[model samples]
Target: MRFTFKCYATKHPEQTVIFTLLLSIFLLAYQLRIYEVPYFRMIGLKDFEQFESAVWLVVITMGTVGFGDIVPVTIFGRMITMVASLWGAFIFTLVLISFGSRFNLSTKQKQAMHQLVSQHKAARLIISAYRLYKLKRSKEGMGSNKSVLSESDKGISSLMRRLKEMAKDFKDERPKRRRVKNSKSQLI
Candidate 1:
């Protein structure tokens, strides 16, 4: 049964919500039944109907609204109400935590996306600066008029070399995976 439920939940998230709602309703109904049973009523409350009303009242209380219309008159009835209240509170808390976690995850994802965009803009700015510097030097006849442009060329070459080295380092750090064989074969 547990495995079947897990499979259903994995395959369909909507089904999980339906299941949870149904389970809550079933539990509420079962509690009502326990209250109505003759043996349980004999030891618990004045009457089963009163117990039923009390259970619903407790549900409302757990929802943070106290009507004060129905009250538990017996120790056993009060004990049942306390148990129901605690379970209801716990289920409600679980729901809040689930929503909170999703909100936190989405916020973190947005922050990461913003950081990536900013980094890309910074890289573009640096490349643009390098291009502008090159264009200015070329227009000034610094290289074509027999004047030494070695310093500027050296700077550009060094920058390109550093970029290449960084790329190589990144490639080296990547995980290696086996490639699948293709259907085509070549004759040597």
Candidate 2:
């Protein structure tokens, strides 16, 4: 489901725009539901201005700004406004996510990035291997203490564990052989 939505948002920008517009329409309807003539009249707006007020309310409330230019007089209208504010926040989030999802690297760019990451992992593996070698030499120099593991031994253990995990993702960069010898010594 996440993959599908990512594809939808990144591939079809037009559809995202249409989806936002639909949400706005729904928000407008919700706003107009409770804000009748009396509600608008309290804000000194003429009854015909209800539609415009609803539009403004949707815009401001969706932005989470709460401009206070328009206030609902009736309790029902206020409650509806609060509910619409919450819905506005939700709709705003979806719209932002749809837009943000559009930013993505191209196929070639992603390949380059993966290659860089692989190289970094390989370099870290080499460093860990060198550190482990040094720690072993130090332990051997300390007269092979078999009684209790020293701090250097613990450090080597932790380093070995991390190296094991890092090695998992390191792909063999060497090319595969076209033919291989079987146990009988004949290429099969």
Best by TM-score: 2
Q: Which residue pairs come into collision in candidate 2?
A: none
* Regions more than 4 Å wrong, model 2: 1-54, 60-94, 144-149, 169-188
Q: Give the C-alpha lDDT of model 1.
A: 0.55
lDDT of each: 0.55, 0.67
Per-residue alpha-carbon lDDT of model 2 for 1-188, expressed as tens digits?
A: 98987788678865865686566756664656455665555767674264666677656766679888765666766676777678777776776776776686555555556667767878988998999898888777888567545777788899899888778656543111111112123522
Per-model TM values vs. the true structure: 0.41, 0.51
lDDT score of residue 32 within candidate 2: 63
TM-score of decoy 1: 0.41
- Residue-level lDDT of model 1, residues 77-173, one tens digit each, is 5665666667667666755654455454343455455555556655755675676567556646664643346656666677667666655544443
Candidate 2: residue 179 Cα off by (Å): 25
Error of 1 at 169 (Å): 28
